[model samples]
Target: MIRRKDTRRMAKRPTKPTKSVEPRRAGRGPSPEKTAQTRRVIIDAALGEFLENGYADTTMDGVARRAGVAKGTSYRYFPAKEALFEAVVREKIAGALIDADPANRRPDEPVSTFIRRTMLVSIREIERNGRAAIARLVLVEGARFPEMTEIYRRAMFEPLLKQIRDLAATARARGELRRPELEDYPHLLIAPIWFAIIHNGLLDRAHPLDIGDLFEAHLDLVFDA
Candidate 1:
């Protein structure tokens, strides 16, 4: 009787498996997030190197060392020195555009105040850091690397110029300013700022007029009559 009971068949049952775990967060390692961070690091390092050493003198090995990356890894990211240099210049110019925020264009802000704030920031960046060198690099190598120059002109300079001209037009409409016809004299308007920036390192160079005061004075000169 016991042997016959053991021969009885059992009903089939479904088995429930345990839940699968997620992959661990890779903090600043070689994962996607880390790769993006590493790429930024390489770009920043290359920028500093190019600013200090100029494009011709900047090398992949030097940038790799500065970024704490292997040459192979740097090459994997940038492929070549020209590519890296273009990226570095583009990054710097892009940063300027982001900082400018021309679209947030406060047409209501006093033109003098606007010009002061904008020019002061520009002058500080151009003088405090080796930004002049960055600018020079872009201009000189831009012909050779059209991409970098195009990014500089289109993204950084053009937007600001358009914003300024637009703001001037608005101010003129409001009778707040006599049009200097600034659209026709972008360089003349911008030159004082650049001249100050360029001669910042020189001793006994006739300092360009106090930019903050001068911009306001210029505004008054335009609006008064």
Candidate 2:
């Protein structure tokens, strides 16, 4: 006897749905604030390296290490050590020049008074703000690295000297200065500042002369104020 085959079809089981995943986008670049912060850190690190090791000894690797950044990061911001040094001077030292700009002088303000208010204030903060250290670095390494010296001279010295000359002419015109000698020898006004810097930094650190006071005394002699 042949058995009749069952004609009923079995129901199929349901399969679990698969989860969809989106492809990740390429990593984004650093934000502007982060980039600026990194640049600032590199500059500060470079200054420290220059001050501690001198320009000849400072290296991009050392600066990057000091900054706690990858070597490539520092190089990305400054292609070479010379560029790093220039950045240091521009950020740390050149800003002080703004205070000494003759254009900042108010109308009818005596040149001596303007100097007292502006340059004097900057001088007082030099040692405290690390400018004195940078100046010493330039003095010590200038001969070997003339390019560094030129950077400093162009960024600071030339502009400052021109400002002094202009102010000297203004002082004489205003009768704040009685002699035209200052117009000829404007360095006379700033000689004491250099003396104080050298004295305090090199000659006799044990007996540091207050640069601000020394500069003010020189002002009195030059302007007879």
Candidate 3:
């Protein structure tokens, strides 16, 4: 049920943070809705630049050009290029965090069913959000942008890890899982999703593996009775 659209507004950060742009000097430059929309356009365009050119090559000018706005306008919305990168990565982190929320699952759902659906939500996010490009960007530039990596880990990865840990705890309490180790090692439950991402994103030319099949086998292996 977790779709891509639900991810953008997940965080309530103010969209119009810097001084008003577009020369609306009489104070309130643009309507709140318009300001938010412009900020989103900038974020999307910056994502394109970052995805295509990588971190080092992407520039504020490129993002502004892609967004069809003046470079000053882009800077008005985002104080620096790193701010744009933060915006680009924020949506992905939000999507992952939203998918990890246990409330999204149906009440009293079977553990296996809930787990499958949860993983599928993430899969859909990846497929819909060009996650492959972002993954590559992070892998290539993560050492330089430790803050970005920290943002992603704290906002998305750690939360999702907690969710899986919670699920494992519940299953263990209910005697559904014979493997108490799952509670201690919930990372094992989600490893295959990354493996699938690597296959599809990095090397699908020669070793194309169906993601659905990979997840199914992951579940069977983990939920072994």
Best model per lDDT = 2
Judged by lDDT against the true structure, how good is candidate 1?
Answer: 0.67
- Tens-place lDDT per residue, model 1, 120-220, is 46655554455666666676677876766776676566776776676566666767676566645555455555554445434334654454444455546
Best-to-worst ranking by TM-score: 2, 3, 1
For model 2, how does the per-residue alpha-carbon lDDT over 1-225 read when each residue is reduced to its tens digit?
Answer: 999665554545688999899999989999999999999999999988888888888999999999999999999999998888888888899888888888999998888889989999999998888888888888888999899899999888877788899999888888888888888987887788788788988999999999999888888888874
Which candidate comes out best when scored by TM-score? Answer: 2
Looking at candidate 3, what is the lDDT of residue 60? 94
Ordered from best to worst lDDT, the candidate numbers read 2, 3, 1
Residue pairs with clashing backbones, model 2? none
Please state the error at residue 155 of candidate 2 in Å: 0.7
What's the residue-level lDDT of 52 in candidate 2?
87
- Reference-based lDDT, each prediction: 0.67, 0.88, 0.76
Candidate 3 clashes: the total is 0
How high is the lDDT of residue 64 in model 1?
A: 95
Q: What is the C-alpha RMSD of each candidate to the true structure, in Å?
A: 7.2, 8.6, 20.7
| Candidate 3: Cα lDDT at 27 | 57
